[model samples]
Target: MHGFIGEFFGTMILILLGCGSCASNSLKKTYGQNSGWLFICLSWGMAVTMGVYVAGMLGSLGHLNPAVTIPFAIFGLFPWSQVVPYVLGQFLGGFLGAVLVIIQFYPHFKESKSEEEGNSVGIFATRPAIANPVFNFISEVVATFAFVYILLNLGNFTTGLKPFIVGMLIMVVGTCLGTTTGFALNPARDWAPRFAYTIIPVPNKSVAEWGYAWVPMLGPIVGGLIACGLYTIA
Candidate 1:
């Protein structure tokens, strides 16, 4: 129960701040309206840092991402029994956070009138800069492989200062590999929030881009599995 609670709230905060940063930039007439990619990456890094801190302080290892939880469980680093609860919490938290983001920027949603004008699903989920499915999947796979592989080395990263280190790692990944697919390294981060956008009635909303959703969801999980598989060997 403690682990579940930690994951729930931790993921909630993570998505709240991370997606909030996107809304800030994507929405019209916002103070952060053209802050650029570095700004978003920096904010997302800090968002994960803060969320991990919160999750650690509460309980659990701060596995707010299914990419982390599922792979760790496969390697016996995490209890298999807890996998369902942790994943549920992560997905649910992400949905709530995205809902909050919608409410947070209601006026902006009303103002942005079309997909071409910043009302696209890219604000809530990822889209490939170049629309090739095969390459996009490869991008997500490689990016998540690097992230989870390094994360595997930092055992129990929820410990003090380590969360910050993880944050820096995320920032670097975003700056480097994330350029192609926006680095949707976690399934929960992309899928749940994308679902929220699809269902929720955000004014002047664009397509959910469900067609590309599989790339972020399946790609991260596969990458994490590969990372754990190699880690066990090495």
Candidate 2:
């Protein structure tokens, strides 16, 4: 129960800050409007760092992402018994965080032209820059594999430095690989918010692109599992 609460709020904070950054950059009439990819990537990195810190404080493993949780469990780093609870917390937290984003940028949602331009969905979920599922899936798998692999090896770091380093890793990955499919390396991060976009009535919202949703969701899970396999072999 304690772990569930921590994971829930930790993932919530992750999306709150991460998606909040995207909304600020994409939505009109915001201070961060048009800030470009660099700013968004940096903010998301910090979001991960903050979420980890908060989860750690609550005595949770701080696996705000299911990609992280699954790999850890498969590698025996996390208990298999707790995986369901952690994932459920993550998905719920992500949905709630996206809801918060809608509320935070209510005026923009009502007034912004992005919705009409068919670009409003990007704020809530990742979209491919090139729109090729095969390549996009590959990108997500590779990116998430690297992310989970690096994370599993970082267990030796002191608590204070671990989150910071992890944040840097995310920032680097986003800067380097995000353009391909916006680097939706965490399934919970992508799917939950996308689900929210489908249910919530944002003015002139797109169709939620359900066709491509499976790429981000399945790719990350597969990648995380592969990382666990490799880690075990090592």
Candidate 3:
């Protein structure tokens, strides 16, 4: 129960702080050029670090994202039988985190483009300026590959420093690719917030693009599985 709750809470904080900062910065136009990516990567990395420190001791540290959890299960780092609980915890926690962000940003909800405020909200939920499913999935696959590879290698480091490296890697990817697809390396990070965006009111907001949403969700899962398989064979 502790592990499950810890995962739930930790993931919530991860998305809320990391993605929340990205959304707020954009809404306010406060960041300089490329600052959004930098902010997101930094925030996400820091969130991971903090979440790990808090829950690693309790055994739920690695389940912070489905990308991490699913691959771990594939590689036996996490038990295959337990995969369902961990994923469910992560998803639930993420939804809760999105709910909290909505409450925190309630005043700005009306300012959003949607005429009817939806339930979910966050900056990390990516919406392409233009729809390009193939390119988007490719971007997510590449980004998730980078993320999981770094986790496979750097995960051995001391807990205190591991998160920083993770953050830096994310930062680099976002700097290089965030403009096109928002560089959502984690499925939870993208969908949890998008779920919120759908329910939250934004004035004149565009409809949810379900067609493009699956790319990030499936891409990262596929990328993580591939990396884990490679790791096992190596």
Give the whole-model CA lDDT for all candidates, comma-separated.
0.91, 0.85, 0.68
Winning candidate number (TM-score): 1
| Candidate no. 1 TM-score | 0.98
Off by over 4 Å in 1: none
lDDT of 2 by residue, 1-234 (tens): 767887888889999999999988887778888899999899999988888887787768888888878877877878999999889999999999999998898887766756653247788788899988899999999988888888878883228789889888889989998889998889899999999989988765667888888998888888888888898899
Ranking by lDDT: 1, 2, 3
lDDT of 1 by residue, 34-80 (tens): 79999999999998999899888888789889998998899887899
lDDT of 3 by residue, 24-107 (tens): 665432232236556666676677666655555556655577887888787887777767777877777777777676666555
TM-score of each: 0.98, 0.95, 0.83
lDDT of the structure predicted as candidate 3: 0.68
- Full ranking by TM-score: 1, 2, 3
Extract clashing residue pairs from model 2: none
lDDT of 1 at 197: 97
Q: What number of clashing residue pairs does each candidate have, in the order they appear?
A: 0, 0, 20
